[model samples]
Target: MTRRVPFAWFARNILVGTLLGGAYGAIHDQVSWSISPEYFTKFKFEQFAWAEIGLEPRLAASWIGFLATWWAGAIAAYAVCRMAFRHAFQDGASSWPLGRVVRRLLAVLMVAMAGGGCGFAYARMRAQDVERLWGGWRTYAGVQDLEAFATVGSIHNFGYAGALLGIVLVAVHIKVKGRVDRSSPQSLPPPGR
Candidate 1:
């Protein structure tokens, strides 16, 4: 059995998490745009139907970013909070503080960002091979823009991979930390009846 978590805290975390995720997605889209404007102008704009909206490209990209990722953040936060409260229960704590939970989740964000960077680097390094082989984007735009489109796509794809990695890492860390706490002398009962 586990201690109870207040519904208020749960709701707050969900709201915060959604906002955090949306902000990350928006910022990421902006950076991706900087890397390759063609990546959005030729592909994502049409995919999101933002092309007809007539907004500036950067604003459109940011909106798409928020729309694409806000739910992801909320989902991730919900799962993480469950694990965290469970961890607190195992550690004999009354509750897991919200601030610490946010900090821990920030680590997940950082890991995902790093993964996206690695993806961008990897795509650029292998541009010759990846672009030549992945002709999927050819129908969307001219060949001249293939490299940019492919690289940005790689960034988005790898970011998801990174988020997965972060979740795993955080789970493992929570489990290990709980074990260490359980085994500590302070967690033991005194000998005398």
Candidate 2:
């Protein structure tokens, strides 16, 4: 029979998983940086130029703060997952293996990516609205802006890549954890025994 895990173990596992996942997400952000492409200059994009914004310390601070925001997002997501599955990892129950925990973690990532993709698509459809809001008087009013932002391209690439990566990671994790033997309550031990 598999050994039981204490309530404290569950708490610890959740906390550690959240922190680790948050860190992983943070690292991911740093890996995907790309410079603005030349195409942006050809179109009526002079108004949105970074040089016009005048780089300021506050801007730098806010950008840095974005990283913390990303970390918090990741941590909160994992925490929510743990809370949602609290009943499954109760004290006196068989402790989940590391591989199982990893599988769950990856599963969450995959779901998040899928959700993000939907959001991305929605955001894309409304991209012109977003540009209008940000551009104000500086927007290209007459001609159709053909030159696309490089960031848009990267966003598309990352969206698909993130989904694929999430699936692969989840698959590997689940494979290592093995499959559920049955669907009955018998699959789990009797409570309080």
Candidate 3:
């Protein structure tokens, strides 16, 4: 039988996922800002200073990036959790400790890797735009190369952060909710049960 998952379960997962994702994005931005204030300052100046935009615009840009990353992480987490829960319900494998753990871990890793890849692609595109606009890294921001920043700085950093945060938040939700119960009339038992 197909068991209907509760709306509360989805609500909880999505809420926690969004909060964790946003937190990760904020932390990443703050840490990056702190680590290389000069780079950020110069980059911001070059990007927005000539546009007559003030600090508010810069802050808004950071927030936009944060919100984008947060939504990406949230969607990834929600999708993974929903799929895992459905799989468990279908196979009655939720009781299998090792199996469940492994499945969840795999899901988390997949989400992380996907996020990283997408981030890399986005960074590459942005790098291209920057190069085209400024005639290369040296002319743009006095940096020798932006390839590293595009790949490692953007992809690896955001990907790992999102994955780590997603896993932790999802695990906490699972723990709090306990096993998926099928005893209620609103639920259904596993096939052949």
Candidate 4:
């Protein structure tokens, strides 16, 4: 019978997964920001910065967008863990209870998503600062715009990547342990006659 998820397990998994996801998101945000230009003068994408329109609207949109993206990443992470736990980690001697695993995975996903959201918030805040410094994307338009967009996108992407990576890692571990097969052992040859 499948076992129920324990409260402690849920708490621990969420704490750890969230921390890991958040870290990845932050690092990715930094890298992307460094590479992308604020204004795509060559592409006219700067016209879409929204900051050029109104400060309050842009600020509100940024927050809403960031939250949505981060929540998505969290859900993705949780789904990945659930699939891994149910299909890959089940039926092993050391296997956790199905319910407990599900609970823990859910917790982890939620925490991870929260972290992703925080990362986005930080990125958007930085973007706002960039906008303020450059006077609405004219002076350092391309660079600042690119950095801001990149920062938010990168963090969201990284959160998803981390969850996917976690799935792969767990799957590999199950494979290594030969836990995928649980069929009854073949009968020995007539007691070695």
- Number of the predicted model whose lDDT against the real structure is largest: 1
lDDT of 3 at 70: 70
- Look at candidate 2 and tell me the lDDT of residue 51: 35
Which runs of model 1 end up more than 4 angstroms from their true locations? 50-54, 90-94, 188-193
lDDT of each: 0.79, 0.44, 0.55, 0.46
Top TM-score prediction, candidate number: 1
Better of 3 and 4 by lDDT: 3
Ranking by TM-score: 1, 3, 2, 4
lDDT of 2: 0.44
Estimate the TM-score of every prediction. Answer: 0.86, 0.43, 0.46, 0.38
Per-residue lDDT over 1-193 for candidate 2, one digit per residue giving the tens place of the 0 to 100 score: 3243355656655665556455544443332222222223332134334434353433432233243334434453344334324434333334455555655666656654554455456556766675554343234432233223433333435544564455445544444333333334656677987
Q: Which lDDT tens digits does candidate 4 get at residues 34-120?
A: 444331232223434553444343243433334333444444445544554455444432455435544444454555455456656
- lDDT rank, highest first? 1, 3, 4, 2
- Total clashing residue pairs per candidate? 0, 0, 0, 13
lDDT of 4 at 8: 62
lDDT of 3 by residue, 4-89 (tens): 65566556566655665666555555544543443445554455444443555336445534664577556755664565465445
Error of 2 at 157 (Å): 17
The CA-based lDDT of model 4 is what? 0.46
What pairs collide in candidate 1?
A: none
